[model samples]
Target: MSETADTLFSHVKPEQTGYVSGGLRDFFLYRDLGVAAATQGKVIAHLVKANMAPEKGTGWHRHEAEFQIVIMLKGWARFMYDDQETLVEAGDCVHQRPGIKHFLFDYSPDMEYLEIVSPADFKTIDVEPVCPIPDPTPWN
Candidate 1:
């Protein structure tokens, strides 16, 4: 009897995968690969890794037809709304409703997080840039 290919299994190595950085330590995994959503019965969501500096963060933004779930993987950050603010740390999570005015502020040097969204093709919605990237060296 001969062994069939279906019985073969291999381990995946992390180093075999590649990562890309956007700006000043902000990196994104799967920035190049596009997963097929229709096959999975849902849209593909990408993982974003932000190792931001103090006072570094995303500008106020929203999505027209998608909801966002933000989970703090490490360090601390502040989530700001139009009239309120919430401080979140590792293991904390927040869900932003579609069309809400909000922003994230990284108050620590080692802040990291994950953002999961539905209909993953969604992009920023009429966002007005408020927080500009500060000088990288003085962030420490």
Candidate 2:
């Protein structure tokens, strides 16, 4: 491994990981994967869960980062990438370029995903809603 890689090694056990409030949605839980400290704030990784009411989501916003990616691990979510509605399900991945306005309108209760972004601490700028989003399906 390269010197940088060797210095940034990390091994995280699931059971030992803890979830905290997310950046955009307080209802979602986020699990840090020790990437921030490892990368010296160059990047960060988080496992996120949609544990809130179906009606509640991140709304319209954009990240102030150079790179951002999300890989769905379970369930699914509905988002508006600019003006296009996109459904991201399990085994799916999305690359959200910097400053790409999007709205997370709804999601399954069991939704889970891994999100990696450049710059450990990125800015989330809320924008005016640009589309009429559908209501989230009610969950049991």
Candidate 3:
């Protein structure tokens, strides 16, 4: 690695990962959202920003190895778990344990959220996408 390799804000293109879905068209994952400490071989922490339009969001999914904390940065969203739903808006945060089934719903046009995962290699977890919820609105 170069001298600045660990300090630079590297750009991660969306196409680099084969993980894509028709339901999350506006979402993208930035692997290098911030700089990592040289002492930590794995990222100490990382950010995942999801930009969603009205009624666009991620499908139900679970991570096997990574626990995640999500914070809504803009607009509004609904966090759906197996038996409960919580409305999360700007400044709201939610913690999701690893291996639990969960999903996010962006009901506004400018919905954006940040997912901070610790021990950043936690992202290597396998994400299994489940069936999406049907939209009540026509033409979705």
Candidate 4:
């Protein structure tokens, strides 16, 4: 059997698969975009939506990957990138540098975003905070 170049083609419809638990975070739901298999584990793409209100948020941690980007699709989110407080809202994109320690402290209830990362399997290691994080605003 010969493999064709079109074998890499991948199309995922929103109705095909629904969000499920057991993702990297418990407070969020993930929807796989089938990019990892199409790219042969070279990359992974998925949509993450908020499942619960942000409380403690993702502690200071850095991923062990070469590239990572988060595109906010709905609502808004607040994160601490190193010593800076970065607020990413809809229509905003964040290209997190390799191994940059950060914390996602808060977000809206309808928050949803697209996340693409190099290497399907990446490790997240918790690290010490570079600066104090501000308190999360109460969700109305």
Please estimate how well model 4 matches the true structure, expressed as its whole-model Cα lDDT.
0.94
Better of 1 and 3 by TM-score: 1
lDDT of 4 by residue, 41-91 (tens): 889999999998888999999999999999999999999999999999999
TM of each candidate vs. truth: 0.62, 0.92, 0.56, 0.93
Model 2: runs farther than 4 Å from truth? 5-7
lDDT by candidate, in order shown: 0.55, 0.87, 0.54, 0.94
Q: Relative to the unseen true structure, what is the C-alpha lDDT of residue 63 in candidate 1, on a scale of 0 to 100?
A: 70
TM-score of 2: 0.92
Clashing pairs in 2: none
Task: Identify the candidate with maximal TM-score.
Answer: 4
Reference-based lDDT, residue 63, model 2: 87
Cα lDDT for residue 41, model 1? 20
lDDT string, candidate 3, 41-114, tens digits: 34433334444343545566665445567777776666667546668888988887777776665454455566
Residue-level lDDT of model 1, residues 44-120, one tens digit each, is 33444544353445667777546668777776666666546778788998887878876665455565566666665
Between candidates 2 and 4, which one is better according to TM-score?
4
Clashes per model (N, Cα, C within 3 A): 0, 0, 0, 0
Worst 10 residues of 1 by lDDT: 27-36
List candidate 3 segments past 4 Å from native: 1-31, 35-41, 44-56, 123-140
Question: 1-45, model 2: which lDDT tens digit per residue?
Answer: 347553477788888779888455787899989888888899999
